[model samples]
Target chain A: MSTSTTLEEPKTGTWDGGNEPLKASYGKLMMWFFLLSDAFTFAAFLIVYGLSRHSHLPYTGSPEEFQFSTEWWPIPEKVFNAFPGFHGVDLPLAFVALMTMILILSSVTMVLAVEAGHRMDKNDVQKWLLWTILFGGTFLGCQAWEWTHFIVGTEEGMLLADGTRIFGANMTMNQYGPPLFANLFFFITGFHGFHVTVGWILLVIAFISTVNGVYHKRGHYEMVEKIGLYWHFVDLVWVFVFTFFYLI
Target chain B: MAAHSDHSNEFQQTGEIPKAQTKVIWKTFFILVALTAVEFLFAFTMDAGTLRNAIFIILTVFKAFYIVAEFMHLKHETKALIWSIILPMALVMWLMVALISEGSYYFDSIRNYFN
Candidate 1:
């Protein structure tokens, strides 16, 4: 019955009997753990990329010297240069930068939604959530276009020593540096994209719930807070992905 | 799940997060944007090599810090919760650093395939 009292501020320590060790609710702590595990999963994928990339010979030449080959790993910017309408004009990493900006903006809106929820302002929460969803949708659209461009390859393609014309990247061969390049590209971005898609779904559900006054009726908006944590984690992962996958 | 109860199974939305918090949010947003701009500048202006790569990773960590600490409110959390998440991630980061350090060493041997 003493644990039922909310007057005491729980501090950092073990869960002896009545105190929250981390000063967090059971659910929020578990959510943190879930995100930690998810971080490991992403770390695993990125580590493999690190190892694979290092094991190959990197293309050390200038932009003009750049060419797709299995013998060397391509510069990521060079490989990801295709922007939607600007065909033949080399705009390296510009579109992916836009994608990064969009995701960061969504993350901003998400935190705003969490803040609005803290104020117990249902309309504000709904508005911010909708904006966040819009940003997330835009990021996903950019990713779809990027994937299409990579898969479709360029106009000239690549000439192999074996007299094969490889148009795009695939499991067998690619116009890019190596099959592993395409493999990791899809696996890494695909997994991150899947997280964004799920985050969008969760955002919609939270938005609908806010519209229906679920949090208002329940007298708390901690649902928004938890989802905010997850959404922020997604953005956090993108920061690393941009560095490791794109920049490095 | 009222804020007044500690034994609740779920976290209750508590006190006003201070209108000043939005100021902090916008400040962080600008910081994130500025850091990203610096990264893009480095990407184009700087030559490709170990130094550039190092700068990129460091800037990325800075962006990650703002997003995690400010946007996720992890900085405001209790020490136990903060360390619980950060320590493991520190190890993961260590693993990355270790691998990247060895990357150059690995590169010398692998380039022999083409040479």
Candidate 2:
């Protein structure tokens, strides 16, 4: 059967030309464009990161002279070592792995929600969408824990061979590889985390709408699909983060 | 909107529909896992050498392609839309090459001048 234009057309009269103009709903199309621009912005940040990394380090002293940690630039694995408490267990990347799984699972649930939307199953749509939101929340919680762990020195307190306390921020270029690296890490990932929080809020609103019969009355679940696109975009950003920040 | 039809039987037969239009999430997931395992293997086994770094970056690009194409559903989009997203991204490759080369040069200079 021919897809009915009447059913698919934007209700808000956003369509300007009759040539189908991408033919997608206004929200979905706009989200795509927004993500495209956001992708470029991130690319610019990463490229600049590469450039800054290329720039010369004014090594005023020998590596042996650098006292705090023998390793240069806080190895991501060492820096982000907050896992569920198990005495005597050294889970270096356990938290990050959990965070990755949470984000991936959320993306899966989001796809399921959208699929339910397409099939017009309101109850299943709501159920899966709520699961997606829960997963997002769990990821955010884990991130908060990570930030706290990073900001606060270990429970054993800051230990230096020379008997000097290494404050978190002062754990800089000399101690943590490069000051710019830490700065960018906080700025870029923090910004992305903020976006994830916003996306989670939006998903929650969409979920509430679903429960209140907003989409049911409106006769389409396209809003959920639109939000799902946003959610998936967030997941895509994290994949880049994992590669650059962790693996690379 | 047309009344929600009783396609329950048809939907039940088909099972819960996937959000992605393509039926390749499982395939993509497996590919991603394999690529990641390779990355970890290389990370652990390879010595600190330029070749190892180069291979790592190549493997990363491969995994990135699958994620963008299949996971993000860009492969299913119209050619115009895909190009609009990709052409600008191509510039990032040049950016990476230029920046990394410059960084290495500066790093060597700093090492020599300060020491």
Candidate 3:
């Protein structure tokens, strides 16, 4: 009798009243499938980047002309300078490092929130979710500052021997590394930055839900877990960006 | 499944967990930092060449593996799901190599013809 009951339960569950097999929660499963597709989009961008770097153009400008002290695509340190508060202090690539830390720390807090949700700890979930949102917001602020610094050029624009501007937004091939290089940089990183912005918005929604006692009433914090997946995915992408765009 | 629900409930009441067996996150971060330092050293010390480029690309892949496996939790997922993510990426990898080689060849041909 027990075996018959177990078999009957699955039969009722399986056929969704049609040919199609019923599956897990539609929303949660769809989010995973969507993220998988997004991953491919990012892969396409990075692969094209590989192709561009390999292709050579007529070498019009020397490293010396572009104020690059090194041979490779304008050493990231020279390209990204943190805002000046301490005069005469050389804080190159410092902003990028801070941004990395912020995103990573946010991911940590996000995981904690997800863990809290599993336990149905309402207050703990709220607190950690808020922290995650703040961390993401702060990272976006830092990125905005970095973009401003990039666009406006840096302190008097360090002069080349031939009187060309060292750092600024007007980064054409003659002025910077390769014109294509700068173009790709803005497009790829900017697109990723936009993702970070979207992630922040989603975090805010999760935060609001926690505050409103929605999860508490619903009797589960699965929403937090789902958002946490998205948050971690953003951080994961940044790791690749750091390695490929900044380091390599 | 019951154990999972209990674990979730325990998490709600307290804001902590017995750390998972994998210290994967910290390991991934340190590996990335170490790789970055190596890249910086290479950039300053080495001349531009095919060999240096090869090393840089290899190290980049190493860092990427750690990020995707540890940070993204792909390593913890089911084998079928893992293959779904990785197999498509293999195609992208092939495309990259093919496109870059052709691009380089085309550039060389253009230079030879013009010169």
TM-score of each: 0.88, 0.77, 0.74
Candidate 3: residue B103 lDDT (0-100): 74
**lDDT of candidate 3 vs native?**
0.68
Mind giving the per-residue lDDT tens digits that candidate 3 earns over A1-248?
Answer: 45554345534444356433423345555666777788777777776776666565533354344464313346555566565465446565566777877887787677767767766667778888899889999988887876666666556655566776666564463234555666777777887889889988988898887887777767778788777777887877776677566654
lDDT of each: 0.86, 0.70, 0.68
Model 3: per-residue Cα lDDT at residue B29: 64
Clashing pairs in 2: A54-B103, A55-B103, A73-A176, A73-A177
State each model's TM-score restricted to chain B: 0.69, 0.72, 0.75
> DockQ of each model against the real complex?
0.37, 0.29, 0.25
In CAPRI terms, where does candidate 3 land? acceptable
Ranked candidates, highest lDDT first: 1, 2, 3
Q: On residues A1-248, what C-alpha lDDT tens digit does candidate 2 reach at each position? A: 97756666545543555555455667777888898888877777776766665573533344234333433344454555557676335565567767877887787788778777777778888899999999999999988877665665455444567886564533353334456766777777787899899999999999999887778667689998888878888887887777667655
Interface RMSD of structure candidate 3 (Å): 4.5
Which candidate gets the maximum lDDT versus the true structure?
1
In candidate 1 chain A, where is summed lDDT lowest over 10 consecutive residues? A9-18
Candidate 2, residues B19-105, lDDT tens digits: the string is 444356656766766776676677556643458667767876776677667656678777767887788878777877887788888
